[model samples]
Target chain A: MASRSPLLAALMRLPPPAPVLMAGSHLLTRLGRKMAGRHPGMIARLGPEAGKRLLLDATDLPALILLQAEPLSLRLFPRRAAAPPSDAQITGNLAAFLAMLHGESDGDALFFSGELSISGDTSAVLALRNALDDAEIDLAAEFAALFRAPETVVRRLAVVAGPRLGLSLTRMEALP
Target chain B: MMELVCPAGTPAALRTAVEAGAHAVYCGFADETNARNFPGLNFSRAEMAEGVAHAHARGAKVLVAINTFPRAGDADLWHRAIDDAAGAGADAVILADMGLLDYARRAQPQLRRHLSVQAAASNADAINFYAREFGVKRVVLPRVLTVAEIDEINREITVETEAFVFGGLCVMAEGRCSLSSWTTGLSPNMNGVCSPASHVSYETTPEGQDARLGGVLIHRTPAGGPAPYPTICKGAFTSPDGAGGRQTGHIFEDPVSLDATFLIPMLQKAGVRALKIEGRQRSRAYVAQVVRTFRAAVEAADRGAEMPVGALAKLTEGQASTTGSYAKIWR
Candidate 1:
């Protein structure tokens, strides 16, 4: 193989990656575990079958392995799994995922514009989307509640989260 | 000034719409009584009571949509829906099924009734019939009529007219189609569903990614592409050209959402009482954006000034929007 170009070498010679990405992923995994423990009904939305897997690849973040059984489970993975551990995989960035979950924008529109992609068991993915739309999941509210946020600050956190997450302030008010 | 009536699939969406300047917000309880009856959407009875109080506190009215037609053996469900809507303090209940409308007339005479767009009551005579029989105070006109047609109907009908000025459009006659049922054995009128999630499937093939509705091919997009949901009317198909050859394309409608924000003036001049936005199945963000934009537009219209519609281009279906029957090209 030819030696790397000087420009390519320069591009590769960037600063070391941040320690926060790994730390954030660990924190989120813990939160996911807690949420899973509390909301078994949400996992049932996947399907009736046991051992159904959903691989969620949030582009800028760590991939998540979700097992959709009677008790749904989630874990963050450092790299792509060697085996296909999912019937379906939904790939999107945080904004796209937030838009999808919050109904902040049209999922079809997002998918059409290539902001989101679904591979494998389309029906299962559709079921998940419909389920999410039917229900409300406010991250800021859950966070606020978990932290025992002051009532005044909870509303403030929700208002700040609305535009950033493409959610309505009204909807965010109900989060806590 | 014309009122802005918006759809709220959930209580959060309802509150968001009201806060964002919706004069009225319509929602359904978490059941089959409403047309936008999708999973994880709509409200429970407690949620409804809270939502109504919230809207009323904001000086906004709440319209409960019991618009889905009552099934033969399930009349009691819709009957109870109307009763519950009234009990929950909804300003009015939007009804479609004639039998249910009649039920509301007799059972809750004090509660106001609006004929739902699901009734597809386009003509003055049809609208007048409902007004005379069920004492309907308003009619949520279908997306099929032009502004001129609406103006004519307004001149003849005694009840107020509500027109959908924004969001999704059904190309078929509202409340009268069986296309979804023919494919899925369920429909909005019968099962309170259309192109329901259970019947939709997608697959990746050598050709591309194909979406199917009830096992029939609807649309095919390239691999790793954006495949629009296989909503029947917005799906693509290949059919005979009448001359023997075949043609493949979107036969009914290109996947486009309706955006009549520019036509607010004409609709108001046509004597439309309320401007409705469709998307009860949307998020509170979407509701707030649309409501906020329309509120500005309606306020601008009151001042006889043109208001530019802002960044809603991203919220439309397929990134394309249409006026959809308002200008009457179909006529």
Candidate 2:
């Protein structure tokens, strides 16, 4: 608890509702709703019917995802200080969640090894997990369609500058 | 002929096991009733039925393991599992707890009963008791016994015996130990999981990538090196010594896998009725390769031939393999 630097703590203490922050949140909410309606199967991979709201809390930075079934709502809450009520909650760090989502590591292995956890409404959570496993979901492929222009631009940039950038990032950290 | 009973964590693995010449395949439902209760493993009711049909068509049998202890108020779930197994046309149901066994005996005596190793029925007396009391037809002997002890048990009991010959080794008596329970509030007996991945963590630190179980450091390897899962028993720990110092090592058991293929002939001669392979949580490809290698090994052993060169070393991925308690020492 004491390890965090004073500067970082002071930054965290700043108020939440900045103009840029509100604009970013509004954009994200629209994106989430668009994705929900366009690709309902992605969220349904959790279950055909979400009997109760599921909260996916990325405990690292307090990002949250609320899932609802009736009208199919998927909302993202960033830097939430308080958790909302949920039927089931899956808790993990950003990297662990990404590893599971990207299939870089086996979800079951991660669950068994404690990298991820689900508490509350086990049956619903199991449904979600099984659906995800069966879905073979590739977020990268999904986003490639949504961000095709950006992806191509990034590719062009990478072709021109990948070596230099890669070299810099590769040795950014040094061993103590 | 000694039957080679293999594990199938998934339906595809079950089919692969049967195709690879497994005499019988054991699996569990995708729930807490079975030991391999991970996120994406085990069978559904429809899948279990499908698996049974697949195995039966191939002249192989399917055994369902509902081996975890029944919870205080949720015994009905365990009971329904036995009923479901019977409904799925399972050849037999592997069980552990005495209460659950009795429930199965009363509810579905028609279903054949094999005692799971989770019962820790290591001796003839305990094995005989389960046989006499609950009509257990076969006892999957615990890993703690030697071939001679197994032979003695076979001589004393009327039931058949199955011994695990390959895959992960249980450091402590599986169901009897609560090391994981103390650490994670979960154990094989109640939750049908051990050193559950839900409480496991792997983090890349300045030192290297380290594996921890329930927040306790298990093993730390250099960056980009292999980091083993910190199953509590296999984790390295330090203890106080008499000379005002600390002794740091794998205090319980080293991270070694059990590969008893070389003892096939000795085990057969010792009156073992079946050779079991562990790892129901493995892949179908892994299941196929191990099952094929062991199937050939079991056949060669039956014909009095020497053990073949191991092709399953790829499955272990460089971990040391041992014959475990089967290799008796003359101290």
The global C-alpha lDDT for each of the candidates, from Candidate 1 onward, is: 0.75, 0.72
- Model 2, residue B117: C-alpha shift (Å): 0.1
The ten-residue window of minimal lDDT in model 2 chain B covers B221-230
TM-score of chain A of each: 0.64, 0.61
* Backbone clashes, candidate 1: 4
lDDT of 1 by residue, B4-91 (tens): 9998876767877888999999998767888876656677788899999999998999999888987787698889888999999999
Q: Residue B270 CA error for candidate 2 (Å)?
A: 1.2
The candidate that wins on DockQ is 1
> Clashes in model 1: which pairs?
A134-B39, A134-B40, A134-B41, A135-B40
- For residue B73, what is the lDDT in candidate 1? 75
> What lDDT is obtained when candidate 1 is compared to the true structure?
0.75
Query: Candidate 2 residues B1-331, lDDT tens each?
Result: 7899998876766886898899999999978999988655688898899999999999999999999998787798899999999999999999999999999999999999999999999999999999999999999989988988888888998889999999888878857888888888887788987767567655546765566667877766564343344577777777898799998777787767789888889889989999999988765545667888999999999789988766665455224677788886764
